[model samples]
Target: MNQIITFGEVLMRISPRGNKKFIQSNNVEFYFGGTELNVGISIANFGGDVKHISCVSNDFIGDTAISYLRKFDVSTSAIVRSNRPLGVYFLEVGAVMRPSTISYNRSHSSFSEIQPEMVNWEKSLKKGKWFHWTGITPALCKGGKETLLEGLKLARKKGMQVSADPTYRSGLWKYGENPREVLSELVNYSTVFIGGVNEMNELLETDFSYSNEDFIEASKQLMLKYPSIEKVFDKIRTSINSSWHKIRARMWNGKDFKETLDIDITHIIDRIGTGDAFAAGIIHGLQKFDDYKTMEFGAAACAIKHTYLGDINYANEADVISILEGNTSGRLKR
Candidate 1:
């Protein structure tokens, strides 16, 4: 299989110590995370050949962030260095009934300043079988949005499959472009679209309900508009509290709408990167698993990510398959 290439801005994630509020915590944990980078890392953890493309600051902080990705077997050769500082986001892990929150400190960051001509998209994307980008990239800046569209257009011209997870972060779309208009243009190039009824309603300016019928109708409408889109996926989470949740995966395969069994997660270690893990599983499973089976893998991967404390899902194939195979007993191996 050819490599998967992901494009986006990664940030240094700093979180308060263990369920403590930002004001109460004196210490914090740090990690490197971004929507597309998390997807790339999850694919790498599953032993896929993945490369991440973006510019980071030409400094120690950026170097440390890329080094962290290298530990997971993600290729950083396409990463460019810039004089701007690295982006940062401070996370506050929530407890029972308290949802998590993230505050961005990413203005003027390296990736936000990146231009279309800075990287050679033809060289990087032409060699890959799949190209992935997130809505977060375009929300960073006008230059970033233009660069992402340029890469997407080039990747399509080269016959590479395209996947998009249009994450709607209201905090980042401050670069003078309307979120809906910008995302509409970028999503048109995607072959596989990942988002739900709420995401669709908000990003596309529709008033769809959170029901199966509405989701299917919304996806069909999107497919009609973007003729290249073949598959649309989204996951549902039923959170009883901050620590316990049940996640179910669903998809529309341009034919039938299918949903996976809900995987109940009793104890959550972290909730920050579960969606990214789901996206990664969908990307990987589309090549390895069949149509609806892809949702099984995706939902399972998301359930497993709730067991880890970091921003990235560290579960390997066997780990996710354990959940997929209905072996969620959490037993120890001899």
Candidate 2:
């Protein structure tokens, strides 16, 4: 078994408990979230050896994040603390065909100021069989891009398999020259690439029709363009309302592409972190199973995430395996 190490920033996410806006709600629930950290937590919960590397603040928020990561059995020794304050975001989840809106206030965040020297890439890369990161990291700041590149190079030199989620958040990348150029460079080091259809079309500079076959074909072209990438994965979604959604996912594993049928979900408790859960499932499945059935396991893990309130920490291996074994009726088990 290969140890999976993830590098990224963790944020304190604040959102209303229900479908209330920040102005309409008296108080909001808080949860720790970040792309790489979410994946690390899920993988750790699923019995993978997982390490999370990033810079945090020396404040209470940072302490809270550390405690939360520890509870999930994620190794955080590589995480350093700075004097800066932790970043935060406010989310308003929409219902009934409305899109969820987020407001970020993460400028000069501890992770954004992370320098390449802060991490001993040579040491961190040692003994790790896999490394995972996301576009959000590189979009943080100039130094962030350098650090990510350094980590990727070290992982490549150490023969570690690398996976990257091109989670193109336009808000975060607005400071740079352009997200497309920077993201394209980072994709060169990715062996497994994950993204949404919108992100793919935007980054690859090609408009793909809404057909699954068209999306997979576009991904195939991307794979050939970046030969280092062995697998390209994406999730497709259909929203009926804020409380209900239909989600299906697919993956192109070099030779062929596979997809899961759409699943109708009602009464979603929390919508955040579902994509990271999907990525976690795919990572777990790719490492543990060879069949295309891995896509089922990954997609099932994501479905399980919608029932939880926070980013993916609440899910466990048994929950996912049960879903994968055709038990989606949501019955309680003894």
* CA lDDT scores, all candidates in order: 0.89, 0.84
What value of lDDT does candidate 2 attain over all alpha carbons? 0.84
Write down the TM-score of every candidate.
0.97, 0.95
Please give, for residues 201-242, the per-residue lDDT of candidate 1 as tens digits. 875578999889999999988888888999999999998999
Best candidate (score: lDDT): 1
Model 2 Cα shift for residue 75 (angstroms): 0.6
lDDT (10s digit) by residue, model 2, range 46-117: 899998999999988899899989988888888989898888888898876777899888887888889999
Candidate 2 displacement at residue 30 in angstroms: 1.1
Residue pairs in candidate 2 whose N, alpha carbon or C atoms collide under 3 angstroms? 95-242, 96-241, 96-242
In the predicted model 1, the residue pairs found to clash are: none
**Candidate 2, superposed: residue stretches over 4 Å from native:** 97-99
